[model samples]
Target: MNSNLTVMKSFFLLGFPGLSPKYYRPVSALLFFFYLAIAVGNIFILTFVVCEKSLQKPTYLLFCHLALNDLTFGTLTLPKIISKYWFGDGFISFHGCFTQMFVVHYLGSVTSFMLLAMALDRFIAICFPLRYPVLVTNNTITVLCGFAWFIPLPLMLTIVLHTLTLPFCKSNVIAQCYCDHISITSQACGENINIVLVTALCIAMLCLLVPLAFILFSYIFICVVILKMSNATGRMRTFSTCTSQIFITCLFYLPRCFVYVSNTVGFSFSLDVRILIVLLYSLLPAAVNPIIYCFRTQYIKQHLIKKIKTSRFGIQLNLSFL
Candidate 1:
């Protein structure tokens, strides 16, 4: 309903750099398949997490948040990209643009924060095993998750209001698939974009990177603690507890580090490369979070299989009743 009414002029999307239409089509075809994979994969992850009760621990609870954020991240960008390429309409309304900008960044920052929360969760479990139950209880995890979602609201509003205050006289083309802070700010008439830049950087650094650094330090401490243990079983247990977090933290931060550093300093990357990075960074986390969270834990896997078998039995029972 929202996308149909195009009030703006022609959209200006950043096309594939260094490639003509001849090359773009094939590339797009490839990307479309990846996009579909992202959607299906994230949906499966979310569903499995919800269906399997054994995944109700603090770790997988945080992972559900991760999966939810990843779903939003991919949904915000990919479908529009596919539609624009195939259907010849790339325009987005002012409100739609704002919605996209606000939501994507909000969820993105939240997921980053959630990962840090997860790392802390792991830290407590591994570093102070005796205190973990008391420290990271259900109530504590709930409160942390609540703060993770709410703390970034003000920052998101700052960006949103700044974009809305600017006058968009006639220009409506966005260089990227979805409306981001950079593209939206480009259209602002009198708003001091430097303010937006500063605010964005502050939020990004404070929210995304600070937690990431904490996670890194926590991991280092965890490693040191693991090594100090005389027993090999103790060391292996500690490391195993953190394996999922380590994988997830790397997947979440690496691309973000690249994009943030490159964009903040105005280091230009090829459009094709940018697109590729965006696609991978957005989708890979979604694809991996579920697999790592589910497969890494024995309880979850067994519960999942049990549930599937029960569902199959129920289906046969229902047919017999019919």
Candidate 2:
């Protein structure tokens, strides 16, 4: 490993094996639609949350932010992933690799932190109904959302800076479609023990344990509170609103817990399994969030229907004028 050697060219990615060149066109077509679905769904969620005035509560405000984060999270990887498959080239420059790494990590960690904030909001709303308005105001959620985005900036900077310092004179074939930190760092010419350790610790704290603790604690308390209610109707309503969030919390955290805990300890599953698990964490939540909220909260569904009808009516009016 020459200390003076610097990166000369970009690395090409050979995506996880299983499928063959014979299936590339078909698989790439499917991937394009899937990516489009995720992008459109997340964008709709964010746009609806912002445009709807009735959804001005703290919970929904945080939800809007979550939707935005989800869109960014998907965007950070999916565009490049689609390109790789469509163009039959997964190669990315060193700078492109690092940029994707930072964006993905930054968006992902911020989303996790936002979930934590949402959990706290739920806890406060359920436990202290009388003081909910005063306690969890718009300003409060705004501040928390800002904090969530900003909290991980320094850590991400550290990761990026450390990543760039390492020489990449060795192999550059990234095993994954995007510039995954693990795959990229695995190719570094220098010893990545410290960086890997630091990253492991951050993943544990930021991605896995903290969010897990929050979800567990909040749900436990909420369950106890809900169970004590004798009115079946009241219980049903309460459960409906909360069940979606709980489902999302579980979906987001479980695979993350597995990956973070296992990867850090040097026990990793196959690349296919790992990518599938991460994809589950990424795509499922975005897909289900709107459905869950719509079914659980009638207000959200009504709002959506109303918006659609209004748009259709406007279209009809324009057609008549034409």
Each candidate structure's count of clashing pairs = 2, 0
lDDT of 1: 0.75
User: Deviation in angstroms for 90 in model 1?
Assistant: 1.1
Across 131-180, the per-residue lDDT of candidate 2 in tens digits comes to 98899999999999999899878888778777777776768787776676
Q: Write the per-residue lDDT of candidate 1 for residues 1-322, one digit (tens) a residue.
A: 2232244434455544455666555766765886676677667767876776656677777777777777777777776766656664567666877888898788878987898899899889888889998898767887899888998889898878865655565467676667778777776554455776777768767878788888889889888989999999878876887787788888888987888789989998776688668767766777677677667766667777887899999999999999
User: Candidate 2 at 67: error in angstroms?
Assistant: 1.2
What TM-score would candidate 1 get against the native? Answer: 0.83
Model 1 RMSD vs true structure: 4.9
TM-score of each: 0.83, 0.88
**Candidate 2 lowest-lDDT run of ten:** 1-10
Residue 127 CA displacement from its true place in model 1, Å: 1.2
Q: Return the lDDT, model 1, position 318.
A: 98
lDDT of 1 at 97: 76
In model 1, which regions exceed 4 Å deviation? 1-11, 15-32, 169-171, 189-191, 261-267, 305-322
